[model samples]
Target chain A: MNVQDIQRILRADLLCGEEHLGREVQTACGSDMMSDVLAYVKEQSVLLTGLVNPQVIRTAEMMDMVCIVFVRGKRPNEDMIELAKERSIVVMSTKFRMFTACGLLYEGGLKGGCKV
Target chain B: MHYVVPPDDFTRAGEASSAVKKTLKQIGMNPDVIRRVAIAMYEGEINMVIHAHGGEITVDVAPDRVDMVLADEGPGIADIERAMQAGYSTAPEEVRNLGFGAGMGLPNMKKYTDEMTVESTLGVGTTVRMSVFNHAG
Candidate 1:
């Protein structure tokens, strides 16, 4: 699915990368731990996480992820948002908790990127 | 390229890796190779901040391979074999609260890079060397 589908499914507010809402993403994974997120390699992927830090943005950037959705209504700081903006990764915040948000996205046809 | 990773600056930890990624992209390297190098180097960068008291990273890009060397003057790894395991981390609780310290750092670095080695000394420092091949055979 594309970034718009994820936004609509999760009822998320776009924090940055407004121009990239149409960007295509093949898969997604949700995790609070950046270490787990870094272990997988996905192309054109979306990252869903509750963690709010500069490392989240850096992790997405390194993995070439197209978007990051902050779960549990957690919003990142200006520095993190600015970093995501600079890297062109779409950033969004959703009120739904992690499980619900991920389930909704999965039900909306977004599949997990992990092989195991 | 050479970079001095500032000590304990978690926010700026991945700058070196990010810059190297941009350079590889601009030079028109293959996307897969670039991603491997970026991810491996990024993991190393994070490890330096979370464990070491900052470090130095040097990257050499060539037609066939890209080599990354990270050196940190921190308490060296106590056991290289155990550290290589996927779920063994010595990072403190504060680091884990920051969404890291899950113990996959070293493994992820190894997973992404084609070649990797670790050299460490007690009360001295640690150095990690990794290589990613530009071309797949």
Candidate 2:
């Protein structure tokens, strides 16, 4: 699915990289723990997280992830947004809880990225 | 390019990673190898900021490998074995508030790099040395 589909499905607000709405995301993982995201994620991925920090953007950049969806209505600060923008990573925020947002995206056909 | 991680700023977390990525690109390293080095070094750099206050990162670009050494003189890991555990972490709540401390930093460092070694002493400091081989060669 594309970023547009994820936004519509999760009812998310695009915070940055609106030009990337058409970018495809085939897999995703949801976690507030950046460690688990780093440990378990595979392939080019989308990160669904409620965590807000410069490290979040750094992690996305490290994993070569294309997008990050902040759950629980959390919005990233300017520094975080700027970091994502520099890395060409899309950032979005949604009012849905983590589980709900993940479920919506899963139901929308984005699969879990790692099997291990 | 070499950098001394500033002790006071959390906003500048990924500067080392960006530099390494740019250097790798300029050197025409394989894109996959560049990604691995970037991820590994970035994680190590974040660890330095959150746990060590800051550190010095030295990147050695060789014909076959990219070598990274991250050295810090802050409080060191008490137990290297436990610290190396995939889910273990010593980062405090404040650091966690910054969205880390899930304990994958070291392991991810190991995962993305072809070789890694950690040397540490409690109350002293830690040094992480890792290298990623260029597959393009």
Candidate 3:
């Protein structure tokens, strides 16, 4: 699905990378742990997490992830947003909790990649 | 290009990774090798900040191989065996808040590199050496 689909499905606010809303993402991973996101995540383009910090942006940068949706209405501070903006990674915030967000996206045909 | 890791600052965590990525791009390395080196070195950078106060990173570039050495004087790893486990972490809550602390740092380092080694001395320091060989397939 596209970033727009994810935004519409999750009712998320695009905090950055508005022009990238149409990018295609094949898989998704939900976690607040950066280490888990780094280790187990493979071919997953979207990261759903409640964690907010500079490292989140760094993790996405390292993973080559295209989008990050902050679950639970959590908004990242200026530094994080700036970092994401610099990397051109779409940043979104949704009111849906983690489970609901993952389920909704899963129902929308976004699958999770290999779990290592 | 070589750079010093300043442990007192959290904002500078990925400086080494960034530099390496830039160098890989400049040197025309394959994307896969670049990504591997970036991810592995980035993991090591985070480990340096969260565990050691700061550390030093040396990158030796070659036509077919990239060698990285990250040395830190922070508290040494007590157990290499357990630390290599996929789900063991001793990171504090604050570090966790920053999106790390899930215990996959070392493992990810291994996963993204061709060869990796860890040498540590309690209270003295720890050094992690990793290398990724370019595959021209």
Error of 2 at B13 (Å): 1.7
lDDT of each: 0.92, 0.86, 0.89
User: Scoring each candidate complex against the real one, what DockQ results?
Assistant: 0.94, 0.68, 0.71
Instruction: Write down the TM-score of every candidate.
Output: 0.98, 0.93, 0.94
Q: What is the C-alpha lDDT profile of model 3 across B25-136, one tens digit per residue?
A: 8879987888899899999998898899989999998879999999999999999889998879898888877778788899999998999999999999999999999988
Per-residue alpha-carbon lDDT of model 1 for B14-123, expressed as tens digits?
99999999999998888899999999999899899888889999999987899999999999999999999999999999999998899999999999988999999988
Worst 10 residues of 2 chain B by lDDT: B1-10
lDDT of 2 by residue, B19-132 (tens): 788778887888788888888888888898888899999999887898999999989999898988887988888877777787889988998899999999988899999999
* Candidate 3: Cα lDDT at A89: 97
lDDT of 2 by residue, A1-116 (tens): 89889888888889899888898889998888777777764675799998887878887887889899999999999878988998889999999999999888888899997775
Report the CA-based lDDT of candidate 3 relative to the real structure: 0.89
**What are the TM values for chain B, all candidates?**
0.97, 0.95, 0.96
Superposed model 3: Cα runs more than 4 Å off: none
The CAPRI category of model 3 is medium
Q: Regarding DockQ, does 2 or 3 come out ahead?
A: 3
Q: In the order shown, what is each candidate's alpha-carbon RMSD?
A: 1.1, 1.7, 1.6
